[model samples]
Target: MKEYSVTPNKNAEGWYVKIEDVAPTDLYSKKDDAIAEAEKLASNDTPSRLMILDENHEIVEEKKY
Candidate 1:
């Protein structure tokens, strides 16, 4: 089994999720969406880092060691 960290970030509109420290796609509009996608990727059991951003291209959320 694989395990990943999920965190919610607050921005101008609402909260956003940053999965593993990589850039997020348009499909991810909020925290929940990012986490859902991350969950799927985590199933692969591969290490990953994601950094979700907002409309302003700023980091809204992140997961670090």
Candidate 2:
């Protein structure tokens, strides 16, 4: 199954939505915005999962579509 992830940017000032095995979307300054976009993309692209990562890059939440 396809998977998407909401991960913190390197600077920790922004977030990005990444589709597994594909290029990630643009950076988002707000976590909500990033997750929102990821959900939309994941739902539209395929039956997938949305994984929200914490500051330490650990999976904090996972939603299956």
Residue-level lDDT tens digits of model 2 in 2-64: 899999988889998998836777889999999999999888876799999989999999999
Which residue segments of model 1 deviate by more than 4 Å? 1-31, 42-45
The local lDDT score (0 to 100) that residue 24 gets in candidate 1 is 31
lDDT of 1 by residue, 29-49 (tens): 565766667656664555544
Q: How well does candidate 2 score on lDDT at residue 52?
A: 97
Which pairs clash inside model 1?
Answer: 17-31, 20-49, 20-50, 21-49, 21-50, 21-51, 22-49, 22-50, 22-51
TM-score of each: 0.37, 0.90
lDDT of all predictions: 0.48, 0.89
State the weakest 10-residue window (summed lDDT) of model 1. Answer: 17-26
lDDT of 2 at 55: 90
True-structure lDDT of candidate 1: 0.48
Reference-based lDDT, residue 63, model 1: 40
